[model samples]
Target: MAKKPKSDPNYKVIAENRRARHDYAIDEDLEVGIVLMGSEVKSLREGGANIAESYAAVEEGELWLVNGRIAPYAQAKTWGHEERRKRKLLASKRELARLWNATQRKGMTLVPLVLYFNHKGLAKMKIGIAKGKKHHDKRADAAKQDWNRQKARLLRDKG
Candidate 1:
């Protein structure tokens, strides 16, 4: 995970699906707005959320985030939201159409990459259009990464 710069107080990462990149070959990603209740927002600000097992989908001509968990805020007893309810994602009509086409026609999956508050303090999520990686592909990628790491170490030692 990339560290958030200390200078930016508003930018905070609440959750990240780190395994998404290892399991899927991401083609592209987009930042989208999320609809959240007051309690949900408060919970997120406390950094209590999980996106590792969640994913995004385009259904009924709209985008939705499924399986994401936001822990309930303790103070808001009556207003607390469901921990694992489906949340609506906001995107332009054209982007929605493109995402639908990618999933239906191109055989791609919409994976939630990261969930965070942007610089403006609004909750946003980054979703990637990706295709599943086969076992052999994953192995090859791991081998390539290992080689790159060793090569960099050797170069540093030589210089």
Candidate 2:
């Protein structure tokens, strides 16, 4: 008989940069596919990733994801591709146009929220359309988050 897969005690956190939430006011999010090199894809599957400094840009009618890093595969040789080269992203024509329009607005930005494998075992990126937060806005968000945390803690204690 075939053996079943073992459950991990801890949920695997492939990778994440928590700063994205604190830096921008996300307006919307879309899950998109990325074009990757051989080594890059292997690195991503191994949970070798970094997205803190990554963002999306559109140029010449093509969408690109820049600043995202997937480490080189261990067995890869000197011919390995660039670690943080701008990678192409796939989206529908309408979606791409909408994103382009939103990006033209001042202070509006495209930020990568998360990178993970989907049910089909393909890598996907969740990109968020966000607006930059001003100093006052940041302070307000921080305060709100603090209040929420306190509320949760108090409720837990009472329970």
Q: Among these predicted structures, which one has the highest lDDT?
A: 1
Collision pairs in model 2: none
Model 1 lDDT per residue over 60-146, tens place: 999999999999999999777999999999999999999999998555999999999988999999999999999999999999999
Q: Give the TM-score of candidate 1.
A: 0.96
lDDT of 1: 0.93
For 1-159, candidate 2 gives per-residue lDDT tens digits of 011235533223345656877899889988888898888877877888998998899889988999888888887787677888999999999999999999999999898887766655677777899998889999998899999999999999999
List the global CA lDDT of all models: 0.93, 0.82
Name the lDDT of candidate 2.
0.82
Error of 1 at 115 (Å): 0.4
